[model samples]
Target: MAKANVKTVEKAVEKVVNLPAGEKIERDGGEVTALDAASIRLVMQGWEIRKKIDELDAQLKSINAQLIEAHGAGASLVVHGVCRASIAEREAVKITNAERLKAVLGFRFTDLVKTEIAYKPEAKLIEMAADGDEPMAPSIRECLTVGKSASVTWRAEK
Candidate 1:
C-alpha cells in the first residue's frame, strides 16, 4: 500500500482502539491488516487476546445454561438497557436411524430425503496404480483429486 494509506490505517486503528466504553462502532468488511511484523510482542499480544476471548465464550455458555434453567425457554432478560439475553426456540428434525427411517418411509423416502455425496481415496487401488503392474478402474482414478493443505497453530508456552 501507499505510505498515505498506511498512515490513514494507523490513525483509524488509534481512533477505534481508544474509543470510550459503551459506545458502538460499525466496521466495514475488509481483508487482513496491511502490515506484517516479526515482533514477538505483537505475536504474543494476538495469541493472548484469542485465548481470553475463548475463555470468556466458554464462561458465557455456562452462564447461559444457568439462565435457561432458572427462567426456562422464551424468557428474556434485559441488562441495564445495554444487552438482552433470550433463548429462541425452534423445531428441527434429525434422522436418528437412517436404515429404519428408510424402511418406514418406503417409497416416500426418495421424495422426502436429500442425498449427499462424498469421496475418499482407496489406498490399495492407489498403491496398485502407482506400481503400474495391476489394472485400476479408470472411473475410480478419475473421481480422485489429490491435494494438500497446511495450517498454523499458536499457544501459550508452559
Candidate 2:
C-alpha cells in the first residue's frame, strides 16, 4: 500500500468543501469522507448534546438542593449503589471597608492586602491630546503608554 501525499490530501479537502448538496465522497472501504456537510452536521449535533447536558446539570443541581434541605449540610448519603454525595460548608471573607479597616488595624491589614502596578495604554486620551484638546491631566498625560494588539476570529456565514 502507498501513503497519501500532502498535496493529494489538500486537494481532497478542497474538493470536499466545494461538494454540492446531497453529494458525498467516500474512501475505499465505504468510509465517508469528512466534508463540509459532515463537519457542519457534527458541529450542530455537538451543540444539541451540549444543550441536553446543560439541562441535565440544572436538574441535578435542583435535586441536590432538595436533598441538602431534607438531610442538612455535611450529611453523607449513597444512591444507585454507586454514587456518594455530601454537602460541605466553607467560609469566605469580603472586605466591605478597606480604608476604614486599614485605619483601624494598620499592620494587620497589610498582611491581608496585595498591591500591584498594571500598565495600559490610554488611546482615547492620546487621541484627544493629538487633536489639540486640553491635556487630560498633567500627571497622566506624561505617564500614558501607547501599544497595539492583533487578534483573529472565525464565524459561520449566516
Candidate 3:
C-alpha cells in the first residue's frame, strides 16, 4: 500500500483555518462554508483512524490469546525486533457466604474482615446539604464531604 501524504491533509487544514468566517469554498460539485467543510472532514478522518486502531487492537489481542493458550500462563518469549509476549498468573480471593462465616467465627475472624466507607451524594441531596438540611441517612451524613471540581466535555456535533 502507498504511504499516505500527511502534508496534503495538513495543507487543507491550514487553508480552512485561514479562510475568513462565513466564507464558502467550492469542492466535490457543491459549495460549503470553510468551517463546515473542515468540521466534517475532521470528524470523518477521526472515525477512519479510530476504526483502523480498533482493528489492529483486536488482531493483537487474538495473537496474544493464541500464544498464551499454546504456552500456558507465566510464559515469556521474544520475537526478534517485533516485541516480547509475557503472561503471568495473578492471585485473588473469592468469598462465599460471608455472613455465615462471620457468624461462625465471631470475634476470632474480626481481623480478616474489613469495612470500607464511601459516600456518593445525589444531586438533590447535595442541594439539601448546601442549604444545611440534614441527610435522611445517618451514614451518608457522617461520611459526606462536599468539594468543587472543574472538568470539560467534548463530543462530535453530529
Judged by lDDT against the true structure, how good is candidate 3?
Answer: 0.53
Model 1 compared with the native: what TM-score? 0.46
State residue 16's C-alpha deviation in candidate 3, in Å. Answer: 10
Residues 42-118 of candidate 3: C-alpha lDDT, one tens digit per residue:
76688899999999989877776676677766666666656565665553222334454445446633454443352
Total clashes, candidate 3? 0
Worst 10 residues of 2 by lDDT: 149-158
lDDT of 1 by residue, 106-140 (tens): 67455545545522223443443355554433433
Off by over 4 Å in 2: 1-35, 112-158
TM-score of 3: 0.45
* Alpha-carbon lDDT, every model: 0.51, 0.52, 0.53
Where model 1 places Cα greater than 4 Å from the true spot, the runs are 1-38, 117-158
Q: Give the lDDT of residue 150 in candidate 1.
A: 22
* Residue 108 miss distance in model 1 (angstroms): 1.4
Error of 3 at 43 (Å): 1.9
What TM-score number comes out for model 2? 0.48
- Give the distance in Å from residue 42's predicted Cα in candidate 1 to where it truly belongs: 1.5
